[model samples]
Target: MNNLKYSICFISFFFLFLMSMMSMMFMIYFIMNNMVIFLEWEVITLNSMNIVMSVLLDWMSLLFMMFVLLISSVVIFYSKSYMSSEINLSRFIILVLLFVFSMMLLIISPNIISILLGWDGLGLVSYCLVIYYQNLKSYNAGMLTALSNRIGDVLILMVISWMMNYGSWNYIFYLDFMNNDLVMMMISFMIIMAAMTKSAQIPFSSWLPAAMAAPTPVSALVHSSTLVTAGVYLLIRFNILLIQSNFLKILLLLSGLTMFMAGIAANYEFDLKKIIALSTLSQLGLMMSILSMGFPDLAFFHLLTHAMFKALLFMCAGVIIHMMNNMQDIRFMGGISFYIPFTSLCMNISNMALCGIPFLAGFYSKDLILEMTSFSNLNLLIFMLYYLSTGLTMFYSFRLTMYLMVNDCNLLSVFNLFDEDYTMLKSMFILLFMSIVSGSFLSWLMFNYPYMIYLPFNMKMMVIYVSLLGGFMGYIISTMKIYSVNKFLVTYNLSNFLSLMWFMPYLSTYGLNYYFLNFGHNLLKNIDLGWSEVYSGLGMFNVIKKYSMMYSVYQMSNFKIYLFSFFLWMMIILIMLLIGL
Candidate 1:
């Protein structure tokens, strides 16, 4: 049975890798010819509106599909080793494949109707994957993830209905022409809201970290390429309508806040998967903000490159977690690099890439993004957010590295950690290679000309300066002995707020549900267990019991009362007969 599951995994990997290569070839051909192919099938027409299913074959979609397939292929293969002992390995693999298929549907669809189908599919399947462990935490996280994305699903439905004004659902055809129309602007707002929810920006930001309840393989695929990026990809498709628009500014501010918030939150986080998840959130904010700034190409570039390293980061984390017997806390993980050298190498390199180290996958995109932000005419707040968030990225990355690799071992005395899982290591190597070189390759392929980032020396060095400062702080902070004073306790309220993502999770869950839950409690008191019982069951029982007791007392009357009643009846009968005569 285990062999069967492994065989299934290997077969799926083989097909996915083949498809990824094919997608890459097609994307290259499309780029060379500068061509987009749209195939439409008419499902029906209603009230002069043609409802058709569309497949858009463009360089962007093909490129994204390639990356999705590549990561998914590697993740599935990794799962063969990571999830080898599980009884439901086949079920888990099927759910992941379903997720990938959903993303593919989303990528190819130019129509809002089709997009919603894919959108809902992603949400539903993600909920399934998030709760794969069948635990309370996983259940809660799955609920959060599903409900959050459902908001986007609803917004997409609104966009679909609104698109009826154009007599079609093909948003691609209308996006360029409807920029100035009021109705179209409303549709754009809905689209942006939808995108924000999927991408977990601002108030919707709580779910991404909570989604860490999922298996690490799911995280590698969902966080890195498929689910979270779906929103960014949608916006990239609709960037023409959003550029210079009023909503774009709002998006910019919110996304900036999101970037800052997630970065700070990650620094305070201790869980390995969640820290990576928060970093994913931070990078997502960068992509959204940059996209709102009217550079879809740059956002797409970062999206691709970020996928490469982030996926590898999660895989390495998975290997470490497996070795540690599911110990996810960094506090308990020190000097793991000494035990698992290859996994540590991948982890450190991915961390460096995440921090935008020079010449890595992240550097090619993230550094250019920073330079572009500096070149643009932006306000001081957003500008500071961009750079501060960048520093925080380095801070947390370095802190995590120190905790896991540099410090002394904090695990139990008799633990055995080794790097002998060839299947997992092989899968990680694919992403490791991509994480190292995909940045420059994507930069060349995506852009016909490079961005001209003319900035002052001080401005050009801002990223490095902030990064260095963050790293210094991380080292100083991590070096503090555990026996020393508890700084977090000294500023308990503030530390708690920052660490809890400004209590965004509470706001999303308890804050939103408090009134409704209170109302339900009242209903239970007043209706289900109160007034309802009185008017129906208890009241009816009381009435029946009262009548029964009264009748029994009458029946208990003596023989004299029975004889008098019989004579009275005879007299009444006689009187009636006389009157009739």
Candidate 2:
């Protein structure tokens, strides 16, 4: 009976493992032969317009699918232990598998219709996963998460409409031809908007943090690997069209801001999962910004590596939260390594990789990205945002370590601590191993011929400088108690502004609807219920009837004949002339 809980995990892991192995095999063959497989099944054709289902197979899709399957396999294995106590364990695994399927559809589709199918599926499935716990927090976060992605869904639908002008919904075929077309301008703008919402860029980022209300496995899968990266993946596939555009410039700016703001927000966050969620936001910004820099390959490289470690980080957080009775407040968690050595080991490595520590999965991609940014012709603001965000990455990584490792035991009771679950630890170790090696493996595999980098020692030192400052700040911030200093209390306003994510959550959700809602209320009060009625049949009749009754009173009083006759000729003439005209 107990073994039944692992049935879904076992099947999913076995299937994904086989898929990953096959994808890897195809990846090698495609790289050597430069081969692609294209399959299309027409859904309908009317008046020379076509909508079809498609599958595009190439080195990129194969490689991405390989990683996706690999990660899903590991996550499913991990969930066996993570969700063992839940009655509906099979349902949770099915949702995860469904998410993986949606991602797969997205990864391979060359048709816009198929893309939307996958895109909407991701949003829908993720919403279900987010609100799985059936609580108010989960429900609200689920709505936010669902609605934010729906914006992308809507934009894609609009793109489908606009693309109808081209007589085809397969965007891949039109990328190079439509690069300079005037009609493409709207399409490009909509695409960027869609990508921004899915990637959780500025003003659309509230959902990412709020989505932490989901179970940890959902967080690891949705935030770290599949759902969020779908936008970046879409952009990557459409890179030829987007490479030369002002939209990319705007995207570059927003991505930089997202990275910077999310990093700062993470430094102030107390909830462990929320902090990790914010960190994922910061990294998403990095990928988007780099992709905007016209290097989708590098961006994709980082995306794969970030997935490995970030998933591991969340899994570790899940383990900690589970151990601490599902309490995710980092303030109540201190020196936990003393209790769970294995979990702590995994957590520290993941945190280190997240900071782009040398020789780790993050190092290969992150260091390359920073160097590339430095070499680009960027304005001062963007340059600062990138560097500062990088430092903040290190800062928060250090801060998280301090809170979870360096402080005294902060748990309410020590007797409840346990981390001996092999099911969970086994799943985590798989990701941990990947986190250590995935960057190096992926870098060598993707870029067998390395590009040359020419720069002075000072120019190269920028990342190091920011990282050191960030680490120092993280130590100080995490080590110092918030109530310990009077100065911190004095600067509460400024701190609160940054801490509350610059009120971005408020701005994106309630703030966005406030004006529209107020306008609707005013319309209902003054227009629909008031002036609309007055202009309608009964009200208008009442108005005319009152005037007519007054005139009747005058007529009855002998002055009526004179008063009516005074205005009758001109008014009657005007009405007769209007009717005749």
Candidate 3:
């Protein structure tokens, strides 16, 4: 009976998945006909400015929405078996539904102010999802996730304020006009900063790996399709203004550094989800770098394709973790492939796709991205970061595969490892199909023409060469016999930096805020508790007490003081209204 109940819920999401597929076909047709469907309702107009609620249905939004719904449905179905034993399954389901709703709102919103509803919703919902397990790790991770994203929220608010100068918050309408105006550079910079925080770029990246405290399905959804992509999508939407700014060049450099940093961090990571989170960060950086390099369409293409494989990757990890009794450290995970061959197959396929194996989903976008990067007029530092990051991706993928599959089984001997979970497998198979074909399908649909590559043969095979070297290095490193594990002890400083993600977590959490915290403490002690109390609460009371004592006899006829107080109160209100405080 419970199984039937579960099936009914899964079927509901499956039906939505199929409906999205059908809608995608029509959306493709619409795009082919050069048609865009947009709707807007003016909510407020004041001082010649308009605040409107709007949704734009062009190829981008429809296609992104289709993929998001498809992934959400699969995730919802997969959660049936994955969370079947949970006491609060409804809470999980409701949270997932809310996340999907928030992402849909974000995807459809064409106005910055309207998008904030989705943005804040995403942050709040993600925090709820992350802390769902009700443990210390979950609590800490959730706080980090919420606070990191709050930075982006604050930036978006600043963007709204800056955008008011144009008399409208509908960025799509003014993007072209704003592209030519150097005066709007601050708004563009704010958008980039906000995107960085949400996308987990360098210096703001620690929260992403920390967010692995969430359940695997949430990780798959948030990291791949929704939360992380929100920033990239925003940049894609605002690409016209960004492309015209010097900030784009700065963004390009930082994004390349982020890709390199994340790839390197992934190689040093041992936690299954953290490794995958780092990979997502790496890919976010890739998309940002490519978009900053002036290819927003390609960035969006990669975004969709990455979603397919990465979600599958996390699902496979969830299966392995489930079978292993929640063991997540890769050091304790080995020989899972022999016990769970189906999951192993899915995992390998997703990893290979991540490494950009030809004809798979990742290859369709990633290879093209790298090719474009190479062809662009980039400096050696940026170019090397791109290629080295590619190699590092393969390195970590191979390392993870070696640890999880090729090594001896480190799990308890008494455990029963089954390769069968129809619910989980059914959802995984959905993603596997998309992971295989979504890349090629999107490429065919989105690009009417291919890019021209004039690179030499050696440059063309650069990724292949790096991939081979990375795979070889991963093998050597994963082996306990060949290389001494204590080599990191000798190079402890460098290894520690990479292992700790350049200490970004510490920096973001404590290092940057230490002085502020101390300063706040001082302010609390000296001003808040002492000076503020003296001046406002007790001190003002004493002053008024003394004055009242002095004026007790004179107050019988003093209406001027009352009149003065009334005028002062009115003046304060008028000032507040003027400044919008």
Model number with the top lDDT: 1
Task: Rank the models by lDDT, top first.
Answer: 1, 2, 3
Clashing pairs in 1: none
Q: For residues 1-581, what per-residue lDDT tens digits would candidate 2 score against the true structure?
A: 66776776798899998999999999999988989999998879999766678899999999999989988898899888888888889889989999999999999999888999999999999999999999999998999999899999999999999998987788888998778897788888888899999999988988999998889988898877799999999999988888867899989999999999999889878899999999999999999999999999999999999999999999999989988888888889888888989999999999999998899999999999999998999999999999999999999899999999989878786548874699888888988999999999999889979787788998898888899999998887776776334355548677777888889888887888889999999999987888678879769899999999997877777766777787898799999999999
lDDT of each: 0.93, 0.90, 0.88
- Candidate No. with top TM-score: 1
Please provide TM-scores, in order, for all candidate models, with all chains considered together: 0.92, 0.88, 0.87
Off by over 4 Å in 1: 44-50, 413-416, 482-490, 542-581
Q: Is candidate 1 or candidate 2 better by lDDT?
A: 1
Tell me the spans in candidate 3 whose CA falls farther than 4 Å from its real position.
Answer: 1-8, 42-51, 481-490, 513-581
- How does residue 5 of candidate 1 score in lDDT? 94
